[model samples]
Target: MSTQYEALKNADLYSTAFRVEPPTELGERKMTPRRPGFFITRSLSGATDAERAALKTATASQAEAPAANQAPDGSAPAPAAEPASTSRLLVPAQWGLVPHWVKSASDGKLRATKLVHVKSDNVGTSTAFRDAWLNNQRCIVPMQAFITDDYRSGGKPKPTRIARVDGLPMGVAGIWARWQDEDGSELLSYAIITINANAHGLMNRYQAPGSEKSMPAILNEGAYDAWLGSSAAKAKEFLRAYPAQKLLANPVEKGRKNPLGI
Candidate 1:
């Protein structure tokens, strides 16, 4: 699995590419496992039933004596100006998947580092990610590029950065989950989905020599909203590998570490 990636440094890209305004301050440019990163999810902007009940009670009281430009009738809870169903939330989440069954924070951290990438085929049946997948907690991970290792040099692996050929951002398919401790503290995390790229013209060259090749499940720009709203059964349709020809890879400089993640 590709364990490292580069975040979008420009905040405007989040708005232009994902249609959500990012935080004025972004996180680290290079995001490894356990780092904080942003994700895109569907946002439902409507009042809760309890809030609607309170409005109903107050509106009834005012109806007894009408005023010149009275407020909207409380019979309908949603306001006309409410956001559309396609509204999205740009959420910041850790770069790992923390299942709700994780008993302690220490155990969760240890597992987070290893859960950075999930195979698309096994995500639905994997014990660690099954719940999140079935619950339809899908997300779009917006990033500038993902880092991998090219072993073609026959020596130490060279760190490679894979990005779109058009120089635009990519929205990778991912799943998100929320874990809560007994004290009510919460941790939100996510994992990027990967697919077999062994036959891919470009991605097949990366990773190790004998191992199965894999690349991230990058989605099309028009499918972001559909991916988030799709049901568990239909979500798998979006896990196909991105066209290898549309991606460009280049060597990125980093510290002396195991870029191959052996």
Candidate 2:
């Protein structure tokens, strides 16, 4: 799995790419599974006028929300929650997803490391992701690029940057969770969804030799809203691999570790 990625740092790209207002505090350019990050989800003002009343009736609805002002650790705040009428909003979150059933923070951390990415076919069956998937806790993770180790050159693994050929931001499909402990403490986190790429022209070259190849389920520009609001039965429709011809991958410089090119 790809354990690190490049977050979107350009303010203007937010509006053009996702049609959401840009957050004042953009997160780290290079994000790891253990670092704090951000994601985009439907504005929690109830999803819609029709769903608002039903939202009140469902005790364990996917509308479960985190604190609007601060994350559980008391850092990485985004813009204030938009009015309940808005369609979508940006949110601050932990890069790794923490299921609500976790017994302790340490256990949650251990699980988080292994759950940085969930396979598209297993989201509904994996214990780590079933609840979130069934409840429709879907989200979009915005990134400039993702870093992976390429071994196709017949040598040691090489870190490569995979991004859109047009240099636009990517809205990768993801699932968010709100884990609340018995003491009332909460942790908001998310995990990226990956699809089988063993047969993909561009993605087939990533990962180690002989290992099953997979890539992030990057969504098309027009499907952002539909993906965030899709239900459990239809969510899989949005988890397809991006077109190979539209993505560009480049090897990182010999000593440059930062994807921001600084």
**C-alpha lDDT score of every prediction, in listed order:** 0.77, 0.76
TM accuracy, model 2 = 0.82
| Residue lDDT tens for model 1, 159-250 | 89898887888889998888889998888899999999998888999999999999889877656666888899898887777777678987
| TM-score of every candidate relative to the true structure | 0.81, 0.82
Inter-residue clash pairs, candidate 2 = 45-84
**What are the runs in model 1 whose C-alpha is more than 4 Å off?**
44-85, 253-262
lDDT score for residue 118 of model 2: 92
Point out where model 2 deviates above 4 Å: 44-86, 259-262
Give lDDT: candidate 2, residue 20. Answer: 58
Residue 5 displacement in candidate 1 (angstroms) = 0.4
RMSD of each: 11.5, 10.0
